[model samples]
Target: MLRETWAEIDPGCIADNLRAIRGMLPAGVKLMAVVKANGYGHGDLEAAEAARQAGADYLGVAFLEEALRLRAGGVELPILILTPIRPDQVELALARDLTLTVTGADWFRELRKRHASFAGRKLRVHVKADTGLGRIGFRTMAEWDALVPWLASPDIDVDGFYTHFATAGQVDTAYLERQARRFAKLMERSKASGIAIRHYHCAGSAAALRFPGLALDMVRIGAAMYGFHPARPAPPVELKPALSLHSTLMQVKRVRRGEYIGYDNAYRPDADEWIGTVPLGYADGWSQRMQGAAALVRGQRAQVVGKISMDQLMLRLPGPFTPGDRVTLIGRQGGERISFAELAAHIDGPAQAITTALTERVAKMYANAKEVRCPWNNAYFQQLRRVSDGSRAD
Candidate 1:
């Protein structure tokens, strides 16, 4: 690892999380493990392999390239793209056997014009119905039916039909019920019109946990599968978190009273205190708003007390801590723990964004039966090793 900071991916935990979440699903319902955004920055290939090993019925991603990466990485499972694909990318998607999201009839026509690019291979696709979210997909039944002729064009195959809920995890169920009804109505109408879809899914991680009825033929799990859903009203099914961010406190310096801590003198030492410089900063996805947020140092809370720089942040040590001491940015250090919710709240955002924002500079270490790199000698790795070995890490 080039940087002291790295994200540890616990495949065992992911496997456990998938098993727990899958138990809550209805009989015959499948799971499409969402590994988009590099498995939410936990390393896509590693998490995909883990999820597949844990009995994931399918895999999902946002971009066609992500599907290509998985295919290249020896993932031969059925993969679907959650987002719509560009007309130009359809050829590659067909070549790689990646499923495309059919948003509208116009997009379908564009794909047909380039149908010859498929090299005689039938293109697999999924129909997306925009129930309530004003994001993408067809809003009305007419929009969905407009593409009916193309569904049987022999150039494309509509393997799945799905929709997304605008509010699934919220306390209110009125809107959630409406979205479900709309999606069901549209899907039934399609069936009545002779559109045969192999798979039908609507629930993401939150929906699958909160509304078990939406577990149609498959449930696309992303955050919940990784165990990072810190939203209100926690999931009933207990999930093991699969990712943790950690860094090494490589420098311990004694700052005199009234001395500035970081950039622009944002913090001043009240008294002569020992400060540890953590070798991670905003550039590594540790946001600047995390200045006041505390990390774990030697099983104690170390409050961040300075402006976060591009490559470093300052932490007020609880006691005399030495260089090479471990720091927990989003995990447990002894009894103290820093959660994704806390970090997101510190930045006024959602929990999942924290992981996706992590850049490629931060190396990802996977804790599976198979090991790679084995770079760090930090406490996090030691704990991960124990956990991967089927012993207790926490």
Candidate 2:
């Protein structure tokens, strides 16, 4: 890439992470690789291909546009849109063979008004139960009751029923247990209605990794598939980070003790010090929130000394460095490393926020692309082979 700054994505690492997570799951349970937010900014198509090569059964995205992008990229896997698409977009989603997340009956009512039928095609859907997340989903029984009739329509297929846990990553499991119980009850109610829901799932990456019991028919793997996990009660399986950020020292100079640097005089050297300017800044997703964070230079930590600018940021170097010296913004350099968790902790946010915040201006250089290969002997792939062979039997 022309830009000196870039994110290195290892598709092999993503594949390995999925394989490890798959090993932790129960037999026959499916894995849905969540590639939302452009695979948490690691590149959606790359991540999906990696997941598919690792034998992922499904793919998940946050928006219709994202699903459409995947379809355009030649991804033939079943895709589920985690968020509700607009009623008007139902036909578009159907045309792409996309599964949708249905939260309430109102959305169905609106869709029916627009298109009385799905044009003889079964609209695959996953009904989302709020459980305890308080985000999206049908919470009350009345809401579920209102939704049942629409789900039972001849033109609709109840492909799945699921919910999200709010505190699955936390140490305390009380809230998570409650949410699980509520989801179980909801599933029981849905089953009592005689509607044949094909799959039942409620666990995302953290929950699925930590509690395999929560992995119902499928587990949605997102953050952990990229080596991000909960801080408390560490994950059982080891996962390698698939993404790393790097840049070069655009300029290096010796600043006098009294000389201020950056806009608004955000920093002043206490002593004559070596400073390096990196060709990346807030505009590239390295926001001002990372002002005091550290970068790796010459195998040592260099503090970000000034207010981050739109196109550049200054670092308090360990010593004098060349203009083109390599800077490790989020990766290992010699003996030093700057991890996504460290940066996320600095900003008091999720590790994913650190990666996903990275703007497109910073080029992505994918690594280990040739190493992504599926093991056909694995149970998951064996089952797929059997199904494929059976399909061609007649």
Q: By TM-score, who's the top model here?
A: 2
Q: lDDT tens digits, residues 49-165, model 2?
A: 999999999999999999999999999999999999999999899999999999998998899899998667899999999998889999999999899899889999999999999
TM-score for each predicted model, relative to the true structure: 0.91, 0.92
lDDT for position 16 in model 2: 98
Give the lDDT of residue 1 in candidate 2: 18
Candidate 1 similarity to native, TM-score: 0.91
**lDDT by residue (tens digit), candidate 1, 289-333:** 788998887778989988999899999997778776778888887
Best by lDDT: 2
Instruction: Report the number of clashing residue pairs per model.
Output: 0, 0
lDDT of 2 at 305: 90
The lowest-lDDT stretch of 10 consecutive residues in candidate 1 is 385-394
Q: What is each predicted model's overall lDDT from 0 to 1?
A: 0.82, 0.87
